[model samples]
Target: MSATPSSKLPPFDPRDPLGLDDLLTDEDRAVRDTVRQWTADRVLPHIAQWYEDGELPGIRELARELGALGALGMSLTGYGCAGASAVQYGLACLELEAADSGIRSLVSVQGSLAMYAIRRFGSEEQKQQWLPRMAAGEVIGCFGLTEPDHGSDPAGMRTYAKRDGGGDWVLNGRKMWITNGSVAGVAVVWAQTDDGIRGFVVPTDTPGFTAPEITHKWSLRASVTSELVLDDVRLPAAAVLPEAKGLGGPLGCLSHARYGIVWGSMGAARTCFETALDYARTREQFGRPIGGFQLTQAKLADMAVELHKGILLAHHLGLRMDAGRLRPEQVSFGKLNNVREAIEICRTARTILGANGISLEYPVMRHATNLESVLTYEGTVEMHQLVLGKALTGGLDAFR
Candidate 1:
């Protein structure tokens, strides 16, 4: 008997063993294919080099291209946004992270964090001034919430905004580990105020505002990270985001980004699993393919099972978000499970690749390294665990 292209070996499904594609609408599939093709054409070929160089060259150009594709702020309504469904946005994230987590971070910060802040809470004037250009990619934005001393504990932030006698605002603070910080045209900075924690739209070129690039990071190397310094940067009263106040403001934006990560992590896992499967089929050991052995088969089977399950979880969360019924704890549930499993899948794939897995020639090691950052940011694994713990225990406060 001979093998046919359609029936070759175990029947490749791109790690989607449950036929989940049938659940997606036509528009959803279209969105996924568009992003997948765009990443293949624009990102994958150059990503390894970009990762090695520790910088994303032509980032502004890339932003503009993403805008043209209606990918930036794709799920938002109006202001030149694509106004696509939440599922479409999740699909887009999956495709982007399949290429590189840094690429997905770029989109997530722009659409989910920066643009979402302005859209959800900005005053009409603020939205009229920024969101259109940002959606079009002519203007870039960064979210400033985390500080040099504050990560999970944003309430302890020292960044402060004071009101002058003339009613103008003066902001003084430093925000650390901000993605797209140095390259942004505008920054949505959150500062402690007499009223509470408040968000302000600060132009990046303000006299006392400076975003210096952070150097020598071992993870997310292809993405730009920076420290935002606001040394008495003054702004008009109109710069304030009127609708947002307290810790809930920034936490809301994080919920959006974390939801995207639930899908994006699975994309990285799929890539690693596919790469390993291909290698196992062709790479021989002791005069036979390594995949023929039971141990290798076990590793591959486990990875495939987790990868598909994570994708299903992401899809379910997207549907909830689209229906406006998704909770923050639910997003945490998906993020915690998907990112942890994705990293494990990547590591398992790395072991299957042997020495070659650690090399940049293949993407397994790079995805593994990027997952380390993903596991910590947008709420750490422990943080999510506490979130679920509290939810399950009926208002138990574990972190406190």
Candidate 2:
């Protein structure tokens, strides 16, 4: 059967070649646009300066603003959280990272790691006392799982929490590469105990708790990275998260954070891709726009394909998450693939922009450097590969 062509179909938009926007509902589009506007108004204009200064000045003020926007814990229910769907949270991550990966890291560490730990494992009193303030950004929180000596193998962590004669829990150890550490009012410190591994909700002002800022970092300079030192920090029995036990507790929180990275990395790629595409169209060589050349066109075409494909993959994961069917191995798959591809896109974009790409005046170099950190944090490439490998090989453990 032959069908007549309809003129009602909309013309293809270069920005959305695959018409992926059609997949979003009106509410979803509204959420995405709102975050996009917020980033344009607040983040994009000042990010270069922030990156150059290696400081996120007025970070407390920004936290309050983000809290007002319900971006602190957008997917968590109650406790003043937005209670949004996982897809919406993923969209917010995308928009935030489009401005800077540091910004997205702040949100991920806050909502996915710290808040999720308390919400999922803490006692009711703990949740009631902390979640509201954390969600409102009145108090910022940091997750302490990764140690100076341990990155992938967290079971070897030297940090220990022990019960004293008075039933007080005493902690001692150091955590490295902790985001939101110095500024966080609270720290969720995971430590080895007599029973096993347990999590402690320690106030930053505790007598022996100090978060010293890590300095002179070339990557993620606009973000707060610190080392948490807990020397005999004492807490009441109520401070321990009762529900979580063993290494699974912290690993669960990490899986949630990695899910956000799956989307956030693509956002960085999108910005770089757009920068390259626009530059290719306007920059001229041999008495014509460079985009007129076959080589430039090929780069743009390939970048576009990968960039959108990553977004599609993130969306698929977001859906699975919302449906409560997402597995840790699957999350590892998304994180491994999207972050690797996103970095490649950024490097390719740098080539398209020539020397201008290296300048802070352009975002390409900053994003590229930032993605370098993103590639290793959460879970390194090797870690995720082992995860997928074990899954495929029917539980063949390779980390020995």
Candidate lDDT scores, in order, read 0.94, 0.94
Q: Which pairs of residues collide in candidate 2?
A: none
Tens-place lDDT per residue, model 2, 1-400, is 8664667667877677889898888878888999999899999999999999999998888888889889998899988899999999999999999999999999999999999999999998989999999888899999999998999899999999999999999999999999999999999999999999999999999999999999899999999999999999999999999999999999999999999999999999999999998999899989999999999899988888988999999999999999999999999999999999999999999999999999998899999999999999999999999999999999999989
**lDDT (Cα, tens digit) per residue for candidate 1, span 294-361:** 99999999999999999999999999999999999999999999999999999999999999999999
Clashing pairs in 1: none
Error of 1 at 179 (Å): 0.0
User: Cα RMSD to native, each candidate?
Assistant: 3.4, 1.1
